[model samples]
Target: MSPRRRRTEEFTSYYGRPVLKEPTWEALDIAGYIFAGGLAGASSILAAGAQHTGRHRLERAAKLTALTAISASVVALVHDLGRPERFVNMLRVAKPTSPMSVGSWILSVYGPLAGASAAANVLGIFPRAGKAAGIGAGITGSAVATYTAVLVSDTAVPAWHDAHDVMPFVFAGSAAASAGGVAAALAPLAEGGPARRMAIAGAAVETAMSLTMERSGKLSAETFHQGRAGTLLRLSKGFTVGGAVGLALGGRSSRLVSTLSGLSVAAGSALLRFGVFEAGRASTRDPKYVVVPQRERLEQQGRGASDRQGAAAGADSMG
Candidate 1:
């Protein structure tokens, strides 16, 4: 009934009562965290893959990066929970309404794939084993890059849910850019072609989707325009564009340029994730973003009903 009363009752002997003073946890579903971590892990795998041969050192570094990211992801996921130990309970019965449940499943799937992929890299001193790890890494690397888009899109957050059609591509692009950066850092000029191509492609996808989303979706785009979200969104664009241009110019001859571009792409991709995270929080922070558009949709439905009723009456009169 009342705030204080609710708090008093919360700690009472009563059962099934919830707590007051909600944690200022950005109101983010644990799914978001898992998704971010999963993407990071996937990106690392891609980075490890740029050279198909003669670059064991780079691959080794990439493997470690991927494993660390995956482990961090698992840790962040557990930390996000109220009952950390019961986190596995998520797999028992999935409630689709819960993003966290779906995310838990995604991470569960990605975790093993990443582990399997890195096994060979970890056993690198064993030449045959390393080759096997490379093959596994390629497949798992793609998964690491893509699945999080699904996780975010399934949410009710206006920015995220509304961007479902393009979200996957956006994520793919970001991962590619990140991976490309890793490649550029490690690969020689001749070997850098694929990574450069990936960087350009990723930047293009991110920029296009961002611009299209901004223009076509008002409420969804509002997430980017407001507060800190605006800053991150802008920064993501700038870095993506700059990095892509550098890659296009062939960053090989000048290590400095390559490094700068790679870092820029990585920064842009990270900003994109963090920005969208904030946007989702902002979308749900106030009632207007949620209520107004839904109300409008309802009103449109009412109008359509009225028109249908009138048309039906006219048909009856004609009969």
Candidate 2:
């Protein structure tokens, strides 16, 4: 556990393990969580951001999106649990190393915060929590967005593990874009300036990050370029592009255009989750995805390496 010490025998990743042929999780399952978590956080941030800039309509729409996303995410998380009725069993023990336990705790906190914020938006309740609760919601939202990366990475899943850093940003941007889209659709454009900006910005970030990761040699985005994964990725790209273009025009004048545009963003966001999730699983299904790059890393590590120094250097290389 010493940070300074070096140990070559320590397991950096699972490659030669005998317990499993290949490791993977269902794409839909994984992406569903990504979508929910992202939506929740994005909504909260949009809501708080609106309130800070003094936009009540924007704030309300954002909170509603957050509330709805939190609700669906809760359901999806539980549904993914093998025993839905015993999903609470996760809380029986708390372990920091276990992302689920940590995420569960985060969700527990965020649920209430999101709920309170939404209620405040309605009933003309306490507006003070808008910022306070939003801050908490955003923190938890990020966790929700990125924890899926940790979850998938911790497993023997090749695609997920390799793209850990990039994945978080992808989910974050996608979520923000999705929530922003919803705000755009539900609110009038004139009143939806903040949401419009957030949606555009978030979508741009998501598209850019995804493209970079797809091109990165280390992350090996090629695994995601084929079959069902490819289809989903393409769908996400199309929707995102369409949404962004629509927003570029003065969508404010035409309610139909604004609504459709927002819908496209939301759709793209959801597809992003599905695509990444499937890609990870698909990578897991193919032993090559794991054995190839991992062996490449180990081979690199076997030759002149320091855990800290190497990681930092790798970070720069990837950047």
Which one wins on lDDT?
Answer: 2
Off-target runs (Cα >4 Å) in candidate 1 are 1-58, 82-84, 92-102, 125-134
Instruction: Give me the candidate number with maximum TM-score.
Output: 2
lDDT of 1 by residue, 1-319 (tens): 8543353334332243322222245323443453346445555555445436655555554555566666766676667666666678888877777666765665676566556556755654555655565555556556656767777777667777777887777777777776666566655655666666766787788788777765665555677778888888899999989888887785857877887887788778778777777776676655455555665689899999999999999999999
Q: Write the per-residue lDDT of candidate 2 for residues 1-319, one digit (tens) a residue.
A: 5421233234344565432355343445556766877887878878777777878788888888888888887776666675676668877888998987887788888899888878876877576765677667766766766676666667666666777778778877898899888999998777787777778898999999888777777544666787888899889999998997897685667788888998899899999888877776666554455455556668777775666688998999999
Looking at candidate 1, what is the lDDT of residue 143? Answer: 61
Clashes of 1: 0
Clashing pairs in 2: none
TM-scores of all candidate predictions against the true structure: 0.78, 0.82
Model 1 scores a C-alpha lDDT of: 0.66
lDDT of all the models against the reference?
Answer: 0.66, 0.76
